[model samples]
Target: MNRQHWLTAAVLGIALPAACLSACGQDRGGFKQIDQSFSPDASVDAPDCRHQCSLDGRSIVEACTGTVVETCPDHLACGGAKCIEPCAAAAEDRSSNGCDFYFQSPQLMKRLPPSCYAAFVVNTSNQPVELSLELAGEPVDVSKTMFLTKPGSATLLQHTGPIPVGESVIVFLSDASPEMPRNIEWELSYKACPAGVTPATFAQTLTGGTGVGSSFRLQTNAPVSLAAMYPFGGATSYVPTAGLILPVASWAKEHILVNGWEASESGSPGIQIVASEDETEVTILPKRDIQDGEGVKGGRAGRPAKYMLGKGQYLRIVQDEELTGSIITSTKPTTSFGGHSCGDVPATAATCDILAQQIPAFEHWGSEYVGVAYRPRLGNEHEAVPYRIVAARDGTMLEYDPEIPPGAPTMMNAGETVTFRQGTGDAFVVRTQDTEHPIYVAAYMTGSSGDGKTAKSYGGRGDPEFVNIVPAGQYLNAYSFYADPTFGETSLVVVRAKLRGEFRDVWLECAGNLTGWKPVGTRGEYEYLRVDLARNGRAGESFGESICQNGLQRMKSEGPFTATLWGWDYAASYAYPGGMAQRKLVEAPLGSVH
Candidate 1:
C-alpha cells in the first residue's frame, strides 16, 4: 500500500490481533458507587407516602411515561420530576448559562504566531439565535447568518478576513428565545494563516454542545482530525498537507510526542512541521526522543526543514519516522496535523496501516469528555477495542469510569499519553481537575477487515477508524445529523447517565420511516443503545444508503446524552462527519431542589 494510505489505519487505530477482537463484547457491568451527597433528587427521597403521588395529587410529572414523583415546592418548576428554578432565573450568570455566551482572545501578537485567523461553532436550541461581533471592545457588524434547520443544529463560522493579530475580538450570543432557555453553545479557535494565502482546505468535526459553562478558561471544539500508523512501531511516510492550529490564549504552549520503536520496523518514526510563507520565524526545540543510538532521537538527529516557514511553503522532519508527538514553537502562530503512516494496536490479525488526524488545535481542548470504544465487527469480539488519553499541559489530572483504580493515571504532563487496555466496556468518562488545561482523548476500534476469514467468524468486514470523544460538558439532549449515502454498516452509538433515574427516555426519528427506540444494555448507572440504520427499516429501502434525503436523523431525550455515528463498507469504517447537537442551558443542578 502507498505509505500515505497506511496512515488511514493509524487514524482509526484498527488492526488488532485476534486476541483483541475476542475481547470486544464484555458484560455491560454496573457503575462504581458515586457520592450520595451529589446524587440527583427523586420523589423516592420525599416524605412518607404509601404510594407514588399522582400528578392529580401531589405528584410531579417525570420524563418517562407511567411515572410520578413527589411534588416540587411551590417555587420550583417541574423539570421531569425534580423541582428546579427556570433557566431564566440564573440569567445574570451569563458565564455559566448556555443561553448567553461569548468568545474572546486578547491580542494574539504577543502570544500567537502573527496573522492567525479564527474559527468557531455556535449551537442553537429549537429557537433561532442572534449574535454580535466586537473587536478591541468595539462592535463590528456581521453580514452572514447561517442555519441548519434539520431538527437540532449548529453553525460553523470561520472568519474570512485575517483577525487583527494583536487586537481582541469578542463574539457574543446575546439574543435567545424568551419562551425557552437560550440554549446557545460556542467555542473559539485560531490557526496561523499562510503569509500570502489560506490553505487550500480546512478540516475539523463539531463535537460538543449543551450545558452551562464549567470554567471560563476551558476551550471546547469537536475533534476534527486524527492520524495513526500501522503495526505498532513501523515507519511509514505521508504526503504533507497544510492545516491550521490556533492558540487558545497568549500563554498557549504544547508538547508533541511521536511514539518510537526499533529501527527494524521499516524505519524510525518522526514528525515534521512547516511555517506559513508569511515571514513567520518559529523556533524549533528538540525535546525527548529515543536516546539509544538505534532509537529515534530528538528532531531525528536533525533533518533540516527551516527555522522559519514562508507563505505557501512547508516543513518536514522524521524521527522513529511515525509522527506520534513532537513539539513545535513559532515566533508567530502555526497550523499542523498529527498521525502515522502505518501501525496496529493489540497485535492483531488484520490490516496494519493507518492515517493521521487534524490535531484539535490546542485552543479547542476541554476538560470533560465522554466516549465509547470501537467495537469489533459482529461475531468478532476476540478483537479488543481500546482508547487512549493524552495530556496537553503539565499537571493535568484525570478521572474516568468503568473505574480503573490500579491503572488510571491521575497526573499527567505535557505531551504524555496513557492508554487503558480496556479490552472490554462499551463506554467511558474522563474529567480533568484543572479545566484551564484539558487533555486530548481518542477511541480506537479493535482491528478487523470485514473479509471475515481470520477471527473464525461469519460477521466481519472493513478497516478501522478513530472516533473523537465529545466533551461531556458539550453533551446535548437533542441531535441532528446525516449519514454518508455510500458507506455500509452504518450505526449510531448513544450513551446516557442514569443518575436521574433507572430509566432515561430517548426518542429517535429517522428517514420518516422509523420513529421509536429499542432499550439498550446498561453498564451500572449508564444506559446505552446502538441503532443500525441499515437494519432499521425494510432492508436497503428506508435505510442503508437508500434514504439520503431521509438520512437526516433527529434525536431528543428527557435527559442529556451524547451520540456518535460510525459507518463501514466492505473495507473500512469511520465516524460519520459533520454531526452536531445542542447542550442543556437551563436545567437545575442534578440533585438540587428549589
Candidate 2:
C-alpha cells in the first residue's frame, strides 16, 4: 500500500505544470492585480502567489522567466512573485518567511481494503514548530523538534506500511506556525488488518500519556480477540470495506456496535455483523441480566429477549451471564469488537482484570459530555466513579454538573440508559438539551481501593473500566489525543462552553509549553480544569500521581473546548475522552464534518 502523492508545498505553492497548474496568473476579470510598492526591478522575484489581489495595478502575470509579473490587487505577494501569504488566505495571511500549515490525504486507501493507517498531529501552535512527514511526496526521515508543549499535547505517527488504494498521507508544519493555517491539525485512522496482521509502521510520536479517543483499549496480559472493521464507510455510510459481510440489508435498523458487560465468571460479551450483500436484518437483545440503570425505557431496553443475526455471520458471546448493556442492531453498515473473555471494571477490591474497547459507530455518537467522576483512591474519599448514560436519540434530555437532582435524567428514549452511582464529584458535565439529538456518555472505574466501602466499594466488587465521553459537538479549536502511558495518576477534566463575557477570552493550550488554565468548577456553560498528568504528581494532591508524563497530549482552544482523561494506578484504571483529531479519526479530511 504505497502510491504516494503528497502535495502541499506550503499550501500548493510550487507544484505547477498542469499547463502551469491551471493557467498561471493574469486573468483580470477573475482578478489578480499587484504593484503599489512597485519598485521591484531588484532583478525580479514575485510572479507566483495565487489568492485574492486587486487594488488596481493592471494585471499581468507570466514569469517562468518569461517575465512580466507585476500584480497585487489586494493580495500582497504578487508584485514580484517569490510568493507568501497563506494561513488559508486572509486574516491578514502572512509569511514573507514564516507561518506554514498543510494538510493532505489524497486517499489513504479510499473506500477501504489494504488497511492499517495511522497519522495524527496536533501542535495547535503557540510556538515550538518543525514537524514533518510526507509519504507519497518523499521527505519523512524522522524529522522531529516539536516542543512548546501544553495545549493537550499530541503526536501519533505510525504509517510506513499498509496503504493500498491510490495511497497518499502528508502532514506538514515543518516549521511555520506563527499561527499559520491555524498551526497544525491532521488525522487518519485506517483499519482492516486481518489477512496476516502486522500493523505498526514507523514514525512513532504518540506522545506522553495520550488522550483523544475513537474508543481504543484492549490491553493484554493474555487472551485477546479485539477486532474492529470499517476501512471507509463513515461520513454517513458508504459501506463497502471489502466484502465478508456489510451490505446492511437496506438499513432501517441494527446498529449496536459494541456494548458487552459482565465482569466475573465472564458474562457480557457480544459482537454481531452481517450484510455480505443483501437480506441484512441482524439483531440481538439478550438482556441476560441487565442492571445498571435496569431495563431502560424511553430509549427502549427490556432485554432478556430478541434474536436474529444471519446475512454473513459473526457473533460470539462469552461465558456465564450479564452481557452488560448488549444491543447490536443492523439495517446497513457493520463493524464490531468482541468483549471480555477475562474481565475487570468497577469491581475494585483487588483486581478483577481484562476489558476491551472499540465499538463507536452510530456515526460516532456525541451530544455534549464531560467526565472525571468515580473519585476514590487518595485516602479514598469513600469512593465514587461509576457512570453510564446511553441514549442515541428518542427524546434525550439529561443534564448535570453539580446538580445530580435525582442524578439528572429528564428524557432518554432511544436505547435508554442512565446510571450514575458513586458520587464524590469534582467533574461531571452530562448535558443533553436536544443539541440535535446526541447522547452516549460513558465512564466507569473500579479496580481496587476496595477499602472505600463494603463489598469492596467502588463498583462494589473489583475491576471495571470503560470511558467514552467528549462530545461538545466534538469540540476542537484544535486537539491531538493518545494518553494512557500507564504510570498512573494523570488527571485532566477540562470542559468548556461558558461563552458569556467570553470568560476572559478563554484559554488552554497544552503543547507549545502550557498556558493559563484555571478552573475547578462552574456549571452553567460548563467549565472545569483540574490537570495533573503525572510527572510524579503532587501539586495540591488529593489524588495526583504520575499523569500525562508526555505520552502525547497536545490540546488547543480559544473558546470551544473538550477534554477528559483519568489514569488511576491504585490497582488499575485508564480513561479517555478527548476528541477532534479531525473529529474522531479523520472523516472530514478538511471540512468540519464530525
TM-score of each: 0.47, 0.24
RMSD values for the candidates in order, in angstroms, are 15.4, 28.3
Query: Least accurate stretch of 10 residues (summed lDDT) in model 2?
Result: 11-20
- List, residue by residue over 1-594, the lDDT tens digit for candidate 2: 000111211111000011111221222232211111211121112444432221111233442222345543333332223333322221121111112211111111111222223222322222223333333234454323111222223322334432222121222222211222221122122223223223322322321010111111111111111112222211111111110111111122334434434443222333323233234444555444422211221112443333233333333333334433345665554445433432334332434323444344444455556665533444364356656666655555555544443344656665555565544355555555433455566666655435354535433222345555555544433334434332235566665554223542333333232334444235345555555655333222222232235345545444456566555443344444544211221121111111
Q: What C-alpha lDDT values do all the predictions have? A: 0.35, 0.35
| Best model number under TM-score | 1
Model 2, residue 69: what's the lDDT?
53
TM-score of 2: 0.24
Question: In terms of TM-score, how similar is model 1 to the real structure?
Answer: 0.47
lDDT of 2 at 109: 15
Clashes of 1: 86
